[model samples]
Target: MGKIIFYEDRNFQGRSYECSSECSDLTSFFHRCNSIRVESGNWILYENPNYRGHQYYLSKGEYPDFQQWMGFNDSIRSCRISPQHQGSFRIKVYEREDFRGQMMEFTEDCPNVYERFRYHDIHSCHVLDGYWMFYEEPNYRGHQYYLRPEEYKRYTDWGAMNPKIGSFRRLHYFQ
Candidate 1:
């Protein structure tokens, strides 16, 4: 059995969320236990979202691993994943993402500065899928540029894009 927690405010309004579970879908996992109130403490935190519950106290700069991240994502049933810049999150760690739907592959520009702006003739290049798109600098959009790997060349360049972008598409809220 999974646990559900409700955070209540002085206004009598409350927010609800839950942890991961063996169950497949969203509804079964986020139990609506409105009457159950959990204060600002980790005495109820857990390891496995569903099975083992271990409460933990995380301060401002803490970061959870991929599983915990996914568990939080699932419990909230949200599409947003907050990106952390420093500490544990900024560092790359091997993670299992078998439950995710589609994966995005991104390649950064080389020569550092080339990542920002190219000199003479070369432009900043980033290959997200089959095709490579030229930008004035790296972090071109500051937002992720999604593209379909198969149809990459069709958009800008085709020849090298095929091999470059295997098959990935930009993911938007609508898509």
Candidate 2:
């Protein structure tokens, strides 16, 4: 099971709500979320209700502020735990859209794709197994894109405006 807590104030103060399951609408629980604590399992926090709007993927940790979760603002309206993957990690990135152009496959985390693939952008990708997180900056920083075992024919398919990907990391199941 997954466990998470949303706080109305930073440092886990003020009104708060604990969630162990999916929540379609969090308005009833709190007006806004400024901080969060994930005690177990990874979760995808949505900007709007019903899992709409932008998504912020979070692992087990404490986010003292919205920026820690890479949130544009303190407005988390919904959340859902990420399902654990039992298979090996496998992913392929393409230099062009629709899975075209040069390609690179990875079974482990890549801190800098440029070093390995000699590229700086990823237009498309295919995840064959496990979950992955694409970072806009190197060393797992900046905007994050959470990917499951699926196909993303273009950067837009993964909710990105441009194809500037610098690194990627795999999500591991805690239990």
TM-score of each: 0.19, 0.89
* Segments of candidate 1 deviating more than 4 angstroms: 1-141, 153-175
Give candidate 2 misplaced runs (Cα > 4 Å): 50-54
* Candidate 2 lDDT tens digits, 127-156: 998899888889988777778888999998
Best by TM-score: 2
lDDT (0 to 1) per candidate = 0.25, 0.90
TM-score of 2: 0.89
TM-score of model 1 (CA atoms): 0.19
Q: Poorest 10 consecutive residues of model 2 by lDDT?
A: 50-59
lDDT of 1 by residue, 1-175 (tens): 2233432222224554443222223343343222232222212232333312211222122122313222222132211111221221110101112212222223433223222222212211223233222222233221122222232213122222121211222221110
lDDT of 1 at 60: 22
State the lDDT at 22 in candidate 1.
Answer: 24
What lDDT score goes with residue 172 in model 1? 19
